[model samples]
Target: MPMQQRMEMWFQAWNSLMQDMERQGARVWPLIIDPPALLDEIEAREKSLGISFPPTIRKILQEGSRQVQINWSLPSRALDPFSLSGDLGWSLDAFEWPYFGVDEECEDDKRYLSFHVGGNGDMLLIDLSTDAEDPPVYSWGHETGEFLLLGKSFTEFVERVTELGCIGAESWNYEALACEDGLDVEGQVAQEWKEWLQAFRTLTLDEAVQDFEKLVVFAKMHGAEDERIQAAFAQYDWEQVLHVWVKHIEQETTSSNLLPWCQLIVKTVGKKAESWVLSLWESEHCERLGSSLRAYVTAVCLPEEEGLQRVIAEMDEVVARKECLLGYAANSHLHHFRAREVILWMEPHVAYPIEGWDDLFAVSRPQWLDLIRWLDGNEAQRQIALSAWGKMLANGESPAGEADWQEIHRLLDVAYEKAILRKEKERVDRIRSALETTMY
Candidate 1:
């Protein structure tokens, strides 16, 4: 069958499923098919752009745009329907699509045409240069610059969306209708509570407590056993939840389990949890925590300025104690909110033989790169960064493999070239000497 025909079939199936959902009283966005005049407008756009619309794309334009807004209870999939009307240009318009003689073309730009906009500013693009009759669908992240293949074709994409929508529709209880029809509300509530409990079993104690509280209210309304709910709550040691989270933070296991719990606590408890986390920051184990946990806790516990100050103060204390590695670790955490401060703090110590250069490099890669970019125009800062780079190259053990060694070499080469371009001869000579002595 033709790709357009398959897409039409998927559309019919999706429309029918959505109608059934509406009939069941589920809230769904109304599907709007573009009129013939709108289709003409799309054709006009193609003519103006000097590009031919693929058959599948033309069919989609003829069918019009759709917006699927699933209820909060359902997992979100895509953004609400975006159309070609008023400021909306097909997905390509939102991006810096290269035009012949007008803009430099990206290697991947010529191979795909963006067809849909995602909720998070991602674009759903259709591969145009592929040999397949129905080009594969790809998700392009504007922020991350990642191109992920989503589906083989437009038809498959629609089918997947419809499948998710159907699952969401089925998950709806239609509780009002069930009540009107004299169905067992208590039984339904009991089942949902069991599901919630099962989900909570996979979460940390902090997360479980937060979820359990909401479950209690919901259970009470549904006439579930109050004692059972209370017992379930009692099973979790609420008082120790923060301590457990702190332990995870100290051990750096929070990213695997406790970070989400921390996010939930911050969101649900808000500033109420701030004091508790702040107290934990004073603990001896705070230095052991991963940069992520430290940064997140600092972000949540204190305002930006206060957090930056706290990080700087901690760094100063560590430095005064002659714990240079710990000080560097503390400084690494401030890179996101206070990059300039980090640069300043590291300036005096750049040439110092810091023991944890590897740890600092791993944790502060982006910040280091940002600092380097900033240093590109300033001879003084570039020299300081170069000295730091040389020390790191000399003191840090080369990573295990050739690939890793090559990556380090590549970064060094880039920095060396930047120094040459900026006419920082001393920086270039230092980087060159370091590069010559490096071994995997």
Candidate 2:
């Protein structure tokens, strides 16, 4: 397909896709910035970079050089429904530099022309080695400084991106475009994407619940991810969603498959969800489920006097446990039920993170780090313990004592060191930059 035709088709789809995001409560609007790029500037960049722009790229600039956008950095045609799109090459000057273009240790000496710059410092580059009319696209990770093929060609990358926008996918959810094994063009990713669009239509509450369940079973059979199914239940009543998840919890020995649902339940507690929560709390069955309920959801489902006590008690138990790997998230994980007020209420009762906390002193895989990689095993109790400490200081309030202040320093220091070793530059920089705020 010609670049002009391909972009025209995508622009039309962009209008519809923005409507989908609006229905989901996005405060965003699309803009058509016509003649987004200047021909002279494009030619200048090509010459300065010592390479010719791909034919597809040159045609796309003529169609819409830079102007289509929901905001300054994102393109209107291929905007992610949930996050900002990478900036298209428009004289950002960041694109002028190449990854390891100077390092002698770098084995791959292929020159790359970065056409799309990611918000997270990653980039989509056109490989200039053995040039074809339209070259292959590769992604450079900001974290590991590694390159991975994104699409066999720029046209394929364009199609895959627009398809994702149409499906209301988030920015980083690019599994369908994975190019390592091979582009799974007609495979499960493509098939499920079609099915998701079909299943995304407006349905009665009962129909949506039933459809969600069917998708769950189907996804498990194919080893699919859970974000699609979670999005389904999140739109409906907590009572209905929590009830279905509880049923699944009772049926399955491992509550691992239902972590997202449990996380939702934790986020959505109210009078409408009271009776079922109480019933589950009283039930002897699903002792595993009991742990989650007893931990934090109790603070919202029950009376303040009773709920806060249980929350404190649960955290106490976890803190005392040997090598505990995740606890105390109630403070940051709030809902509309005045959860923040309740969290502050427990500030006196609940134990704030400290250097002496069991996991902090552990020889390996402390709770702070373990929670970062929680989905690896057990599948159950995959709650984020890091939030309790990482976000505790960021909640727009001064600490009650010096303990939490010092713990903030500890959490930031520990996380930064780990992030550096893990080669996660984004995380390392974020944590390292905040280390000063933690310093007394």
Candidate 3:
């Protein structure tokens, strides 16, 4: 027979065997397969991965390679049982190659006599309705012939697919289904919420926020709160307000997600927040938790005459304790780093003083000097130059020109010299001497 015909006959026979086991109510797969054909498939796959097959696996596959089985939500073909109880799913299993993108080329190849034993022992041929259309309903439901059952019995899998099918068949506009799915649901609901939120044909903003909040609570349980979720629900989507609020609370960052809390803090706090000296801090954007804290301070304690000062004081204290220093030599680069929370709070005037001296520690001096020239090498750079000269004078050194501060003149030279552990202290002293000379 041709390859195609042979594969079809194999599947037909495999499907028949599975149906027999289901009718018998044998929850455990007890079928077997012809060993040689299965071995051929395994050997071909082994050749593709260029690895030696374990002797034991070779023996098992050889002994019962021709078995066909139908068990509760597990598949068996000959001796090869793809189950948690089996060696295949274990960490040390020999069959765990091609994490993904393996069978793309040989999808049509009859690699094994796959089986579909549902959770409730509902066995049958492959779920054909799932593939009756061009793009399978379970788009990833079935691949080649490996039954993609997410550990669900037949009854449960069928119910899920049926519901998903109703949504899919209707372009996912199923409000009734969404509301039902939301009932008693727990955990990070991003995936489900994303699907259902879009699927709902009609839902008010208030309703959506409430649903989103539930989703947020679920995510909190799972530790899935991240920047992506915060940004997604940052906007005023009435359909997702509650979820956005949950994210805001979870994130605790004040300046980050400009959501209900962002506006809420500004609104509730009134002029206090409007005039409040904004404070800043950096924390992981776990759903804008920091932003929410900022809002809380502004909302709860603004316009109390000392409220703004108090808030700024508290913020500054937190930052200070964190050892954030506002040094001309070190902090000037903060301007270019957008995520440095402090930079968001600093007014433009705060940067004016050290704007010109940033080049001293720049990654590339050529670029810095080029920019300096573009800025007319004016009073700002002149001040930097004079400062460096003063530092050299203070250190009792002469201004030897740009080459004198060789570290800033060429990026690679300093990096190479700095990596030498023996020269570290000497390099540091030389740099200090150079700075003192330049300043004086």
Q: Write one digit per residue (lDDT tens) for candidate 1, span 1-440.
A: 75446646755755664564444233456554333226566666677667766666665555544222232221121111110010111332322333223256677777776654544455656777875666776656555565555456655645553433322111122222123212222455534543442232232333434675554333222222234434454455545444544444355432344444455344334345567667657766465544456676676667767776776676667668886444345444654453345554555544333334323432343244444443452444445455555555566632221234454455556666665444455655765676677643
Error of 1 at 110 (Å): 4.3
In terms of TM-score, the best-performing candidate is 2
lDDT tens digits, residue span 82-181, model 2: 2333223333233454665455745454467765555566666777674777777677776666667666776776566556443211224354446573
Model 1 scores a TM of 0.36
Ranking by lDDT: 2, 1, 3
Q: TM-score for every candidate vs. truth?
A: 0.36, 0.55, 0.26
Q: After TM-score superposition, what is the CA distance of residue 372 in candidate 3 from its true location, in Å? A: 10
Local accuracy by lDDT, each model: 0.47, 0.47, 0.34
Which runs of model 1 end up more than 4 angstroms from their true locations? 1-37, 66-110, 116-123, 130-133, 140-147, 161-284, 290-440
lDDT of 3 by residue, 222-282 (tens): 2223344344345445334433433454555433233344443333223433333243333
User: Number of clashing pairs, model 3?
Assistant: 56
Report the lDDT of model 1 for residue 75: 16
Give per-residue lDDT, candidate 3, residue 213: 54
Q: Give the better candidate number (2 or 3) by lDDT.
A: 2
